[model samples]
Target: MVDIPVELPAGPETVTGDWTVGDREDIVLIAHGAGAGKDHPFLVGLADALGAEGLSTLRFNFPYVEKGRRMPGPAAHAIATWNAVVAWARTQEPSARVWATGKSYGGRMASMAVAEGLVVDGLAYLGYPLHAPGKPEKPRAEHLPVIATPQLFIEGTNDPFIQPLEQFETVVSTCQNARVAWVDGGGHSFEVKGQKRPAAEIGASFARVIAEFIRG
Candidate 1:
């Protein structure tokens, strides 16, 4: 457990994180989605799998989660948290590279942080929520074009969040450097229709691809 300090407008606040040390020299910071905290089984499985791949992981909670709120706080708050967490990771392992990844909403916030100049080696989105379901007209992608770091968007083919895939592709095309990985017959949560799989297993399944993307 680690306490990361964030400077919010109201005052200085701290969020908790779990640091899973690995034998490797690189570390990845994992953030949770809007609906869950860092302890979610999916994130735990993802972190553990990454550790097995010889990579360290620090999965942390955003301010809202710490405060017991169901809704996400301001983007500025999330961005500030990102800044603090990355700084902590770099200080913890000065020589090691740091990468940022998150599930859904969390991943979008990381992208926003990088766009606004939070440094990290690369980024991977477990499922980038391009827009709300049935609402592709309002894409959350303007900042994506400005982010220079390598981005990997692991999306599900049937996810309604990115319905009418062409719009999502158009958004990806504007990025300076980006890659997309589609999960066949997958939903927003990477849950395949009529196929039963544990949440942790789904998360762990992406470890190899994520590791490969970060190394490439």
Candidate 2:
């Protein structure tokens, strides 16, 4: 594991990341959600599982998280952070294909960054927050249509952020190359109802799903 300091041009703040080398040429740069840092158990589990599947992984903290703030910073900062991390990842393995994957807010920001002209081979959303809880009328999906890269949205049926299933379906339809993987009874964190499991176990199960998508 190599510690990387991501320097942002705006605040000049340094965000930290942990890089886990894998045997595959496909590299994934993952970011955390609003409430957790890159070292969150769920993300660590996911990174480990992906590494086992032969995909290199880089998990990084957002600027606010690095500062120990519970609330996330503005979208611009998150986008810049994504840019910095992806840029640094490219330097590590120039021949490797880099994909962007994130949980919730992190995923959404990745999409936004891609729409704003960030380069990535593909994208995966662990659990996209289509809209704020109980605010379906204000869906955050205007940028999905412009993102031409292949995308996989792993969502839970019980996620309040994307309720009334049809809404999410409609939003995905606008994308040129996007698909959904519905997790039965799963919440925003991919936790299934009444099915207790360790965070790592749950993350491992999704590794195959994501790897298959990347391979396709």
Candidate 3:
């Protein structure tokens, strides 16, 4: 139940994070998806699971969430928020490594930040939206090739955000220290029809995959 204190930039209101820090261990700073906040059940479950694996986690909300908007903030705003979070993470545990990760839009922004030279040890995208559904021609992976940090991208097979599996595989193969984990029969939200598993369980599976990927 440890709180990961953070300081936001002067213009934006201060933000707090729900954090679970592993004993003397490094941390993974995570941002929620477009429709959820830091306390979303899925995020909480993932943080708990990652904590069990001896990895600390810091999950926070974006500015849009702070404003109670259904949509996320602009790309530049998200990147700015991430930049602040990373800066906070570094100060909180100077000796511990800091990793940036997120779900969907959050994840993509983290990648963008990394490509722009925002410092971090690595990255993990719970679901990297390659492109909007029915829009494969406008994929969002061009900058991926330039990012050098170790990265893990977990995605559902049926996610509308990313198209045909073949192309996704090819893109991942081109990035250094990057790999993909597929969640069978999962939609963009990782929901599998008729499967009784709770949202928290699905998130735990993602946490497990990320833990294993980082361990390797």
Compared to the true structure, candidate 1 yields what TM-score?
Answer: 0.98
Question: TM-scores for all candidates?
Answer: 0.98, 0.96, 0.91
- Residue 79 C-alpha lDDT in model 3: 79
- lDDT of every model, 2 decimals: 0.94, 0.89, 0.82
Candidate 1 Cα outliers beyond 4 Å, as residue runs: none
Instruction: Give one clash count per candidate, in the order shown.
Output: 0, 0, 0
* Model 3 lDDT, residue 89, Cα: 75
Worst 10 residues of 3 by lDDT: 1-10
Per residue, candidate 3 scores C-alpha lDDT tens digits across 1-216 of: 333323344464656687666844478888888888888888878888888889988898887787688997567778787888888777778888788889888899999989988988889998899988888888999899999999988888998887787888888998988977878888887998789777777787777677776667
Global CA lDDT of candidate 2, please?
A: 0.89
Cα lDDT tens digits for candidate 1, 1-216: 989999999999999999988954789999999999999999999999999999999999999999999999999999999999999998888988899999999999999999999999999998899999988888899999999999999999999999888999999999999989999999999999999999999999999999999778
Model 2, total clashes: 0
